[model samples]
Target: MKSTVADEMCTEDLGNVLPSVYKSVRLSVASPPLLHVNASLLLLTDEALSEVFGAVVEDSEEYQTLKVLRKGGITSILFSRPHHANVLDMKMVEELTTALHSARLDPTTRLTVTAATGRVYCGGHKPGLDAASGLQLRDGLHSLVKCVLEFPKPLAALVMGPCVGVLAGLLPLYDVVLAAKGACFQTTVVESGETPCGCCTYTYPRLMGHARAAHMLLLGHELECGEAQRSGLVTEVLPTTAFHHTALSTLHPLTATPPPALSHTKQLMRQPLLNPLTSVHGSAIMTNTTQVISMARYFAAGVKRNSDNAP
Candidate 1:
């Protein structure tokens, strides 16, 4: 088979890069294990772990918002623009959509993970762009959300900090969400005078129940890591010190599973949501696009007023 971008990116053998990390620890069922060392320490030292995870396979050439990293059977899409707190701009959305589509087509890819490298996972859409730009932004975001929803492989998120706005809205789409102690989640669309996009209207209620989903979407309630896990929005919460190791452990299981079986299982599990998700997706995009255009006007007018009043 011809190598796709994902296949090309993941060509480096992880086994060669970190031999010690790839070795399995032996445990005897009947007797105490010979080694008394900490299991976490045996996997990889922090420095080695960082080298493995932080290795960038594809830098943002067209899309400055994120980078793609591949190791073993896993492909990680990291939101790279921490300067804007990894905010989702139109360009970012388009880039993400293209990446997702590429991953979908790659047979070598078994699992996909989305993460952020800053204090925020995603800060929602950028503001103050023109109405036409806002519409393009909506279209781009809608396509990205659709890609995530219909992704064949299991998708996971490692949230290390505050996950706000559209990023929070995407939690339910992920098969698993590992959050750090400092991580928090909020859906800000309704509070911002916009309806929820990303099929959040359907996904949230299914994952967290109508009441809690209502609290988040309608009342703008922010869930701390503990609350998010309790509400079923987060799969696990780890201390900042342990978050990376724990996230690796969580995704390690999927590497063992056959890709075709895992993909089919994911498809079966998401089958129930597909119809409703499709039904709501179009309207959600339309409503959000209209609201974005209007909100842009409001933001521009406020900026003009401030400028006029100054000095």
Candidate 2:
């Protein structure tokens, strides 16, 4: 069957390419053992953890913003443009959406992991968000989030640094969010006086409670690795040591679970949320696009006035 455990799980152990995130923290903290250490992600040929330093890549093609690495039952989508802090521009968002859709259709794919290069997981929306590009950005992000919400296979995020704005809000929605000890999360939509998109208003409150969600979105309160974990956002916090091996090891258990079980469970759990989140994303996109674009114009004008006065 498509969901057979043997057919869906990773074939090899994960200790080869990755490193430990926190050397002092034990992987076996929970009673039942949170990590099984059997999974390895073909994130990169080398799993080049140093790529987390933001290697400068000249943007050239459709693959510039991110790259896809596939092996066995797992597909890893790495945000490749660390030089830009892995910002989800229209291209990035749309590309990600396409990748998710592809993964959903691929019978061989049992899992999809989204990891970022450099110090940031996702730097948020486009930097120069303006009225002209607002609709495009909104549409792209709306599509991306919708893909994630409906993804049948397991979805994981390898977060290393600052997970901000739209992505900060997205962590709560992923099946697993593995974070480095230094990773931080912050929702910035309200900071710009924009409505929260990516189903954040609906999801965050459900995961962490309304007060905490309001604190995060309304006040832009940042949650460090510990806080995020305590608040139930992160699945695991890793030490900063083993670059690739240690982090990927936690996913070994994914290979143990039957594919159908995971898929069915996810569908069942997310079924109730599907409609609400879809509705929220649609309505929020309209408000988010317009309000954020207007705010961007205001900030730009303010910057111009300050610059002119300086001269």
Candidate 3:
């Protein structure tokens, strides 16, 4: 991918500023004498910052399912396919993985934020796939979740509507989850006769407790925003009118922190989960993939049976 002029300038600015910021953070942590050092001096000028952050990079390539917009050290990955209810099929999953990968490499992006268009954050998996496409979808979803887990920078999810299926599975992986009023979350894997993917087996229990996780995954419970917040699944819930503003305000602190320190903190916090998650990721994905194929075939047979018996 060719770097745009704005991207190049942002990279240059980050190159100029990050080393000094990293040094200051290191010094502040290592030696008491340097604790009072001013880190703000390393910040880029307002004009340069505007130029770098204000640039919006639309996905013009093969995968146009999402838009990547950068502003003030934050990269917002907005779901673009409202017509499809932002379903995470194989193709969209691949695109999301690629976007996250690019954001991870982008020097100016200190944090990544995810949001979707329309009323549903994600409507769930693409329906009715054969065994081959099911396996492909499973792999793509696994890759997408892995990218989110391994992303060095902080990850935030801004939920303005219902978040369901595989997308709901990803909520626990986010560092911060800000939901708008009326937003709900549910995992429909059981309903579909498939197991959970994206390490939800591990993350849901940790984030929302064992009982709630079991209730959700096993019984297919839908969690409203308040219940989600109480269960610790959501960081906060705000009015739809104020969600974007509140989310930005909440993320403002990260801009002041050194990127290295932020990344290090995120890594340390995630290390324990990562260890167990790695071992299970492959097996879970494979199991779910097989289940998806089987479920599809079963449903197809049932539909055929009904059609044959119908008038």
Give lDDT per model, in order.
0.69, 0.67, 0.69
For model 3, the superposed segments whose C-alpha errors exceed 4 Å read: 1-59, 299-311
Candidate 3 TM-score over all chains jointly: 0.77
Ten contiguous residues minimizing lDDT sum, candidate 1: 22-31
**Highest-scoring model, TM-score:** 1
Judging by lDDT against the true structure, name the best candidate.
Answer: 3
Tens-digit lDDT track of model 1 for 1-311: 55433322223222222213111111111012112223222212223334647554564476566677777777877776555556676778888888778777877778888876534466566643678887777777778888888988989998865566777887888898998766777676465577877788888888789998998788777777788898888998876655666787778989899888998898999998899898888888878777878888898899999999999
Model 3, range 1-311, lDDT digits (tens) per residue?
Answer: 55443333222321123212111111111112112212211111223223333544553775577767787788878776545556666778888898899889999888888876444466677744566777777778878888887888989998866677787888888889998777778775465567877788888898788999999888777788899999888999886654556677887798779999999998899898787987777778778867877877887898899999999
Residue 4 accuracy (lDDT) in model 1: 38
The residue ranges of model 1 lying beyond 4 angstroms of the native Cα positions read 1-56, 296-311
Clashes of each: 0, 17, 0
Steric clash count of candidate 3:
0
| TM-score of every model versus the real structure | 0.78, 0.75, 0.77
1-311 in candidate 2: lDDT tens per residue? 24323212222222221122111122122112112222122122223432432233323365756777666576777886545556677888888888789878988878788886544466666644566677667777777777887788899888866677777777667899898767777776454466767688888888889999898878777777898898899988997555345666678578568899999999998898888888888888777767767877897899899999995
Q: Which pairs clash (backbone N, Cα, C closer than 3 Å) in model 1?
A: none
Positional deviation of residue 33's Cα in model 1 after best superposition, in angstroms:
33
